[model samples]
Target: MKRTLTTFIATLALIALGAGARPAGAAGVTNAVAAAGTTNIVASSDGKFTPSTIVMHVGETTTLHLTSSGGVHGLVSNRLHIPLTRIQPGKAVNVAVTPSKAGTYVLPCAIFCGLNHANMKLTVIVKQ
Candidate 1:
């Protein structure tokens, strides 16, 4: 009887340790999660998202600052993903996006900027 009790106790401890050792996200998004509005993403000198890409876990919101050194750009997404708002050249536009799904969403340029107008894109990394 004592031997059986000892074995049971050891098994429980092993199980507990294994569960604690596991990560939060099944996909392994272990980095610091950037909560909503934690940081603002800005467009690079070439009128592109500086970091260009963003990583976020499920159930989090974030703010993006799309700025252009020259020319006017708007946040254009499936729902006005262009610049957050209409800002003059050299100005920054703040846009908030809440990704309910785990996938890549594009932030296109709302305005007709010509030539490379279709190149504006933002990658939202959602951890499922």
Candidate 2:
């Protein structure tokens, strides 16, 4: 009886741990975007942008395909002058960016996304 109880408790613990764990999709990603014409970025509920970094070439127009989950989110880059309005949840918004010069810029979430809003920064690197 004692051995059976111990085994049952161990099994329960394992199940509990597994249930609490989140899949890879929940966490932000690196190199998540493929191709140069358009890149897809998914804003997660945890206030993170998938494919945190965006790389492109100067003079090459790149369109950012943005989506949000859980709530509304907005993306904007002051330096790049990429105008992005409100992005509804589960809806996609596109913003075209053409950098004449090569530099690194940060695109931040314009709308409030929660406590971690400050962390929701997208790195944009333009190569010559």
Candidate 3:
């Protein structure tokens, strides 16, 4: 009876250890996308960026979270030197940017999505 109890305790300990051993990226799996501080931008199949204007303060750092609603898209900003981030349907992309001075920056979709792709413009306003 004592041997059985010891074996049961050892099994429980092994189970506990295994439960604590999580693989990389397992924690906060639901938070794989942008965090709370980043600005969210949604790219739609209709060739538009929702909330086309992003406001930020100069000398402040922030991230832009880009996601697609209906189809694949990308975010491009020549002034910010941001490379195109492929935003697949249901996936999110993040871009970190900091404006040194107060000004207006234009961000657009680098990929040809649809008819209104040329009109897909995102404005970034930095203020003092």
lDDT of each model, Cα atoms only?
0.56, 0.74, 0.73
For 16-55, candidate 2 gives per-residue lDDT tens digits of 7875553334223324545559887777767777778878
> In model 2, where is the ten-residue run with the lowest total lDDT?
22-31
TM-score, prediction 1: 0.53
Q: lDDT of model 2 at residue 70?
A: 57
- Tens digit per residue, CA lDDT, model 3, 30-118: 23444555877777789877667878777677787777766677776666667778876645678888777788988777788888888
Q: Which lDDT value does model 2 have at 23?
A: 30
TM-score leader: 2
Residue 97, model 1, lDDT: 60
Total clashes in model 2, counting residue pairs 3 or more apart in sequence or in different chains: 0
Q: What's the distance in Å from true for residue 89, model 2?
A: 1.4
Scored against the true structure, residue 31 in model 1 reaches a CA lDDT of 31
lDDT of 1 at 100: 67
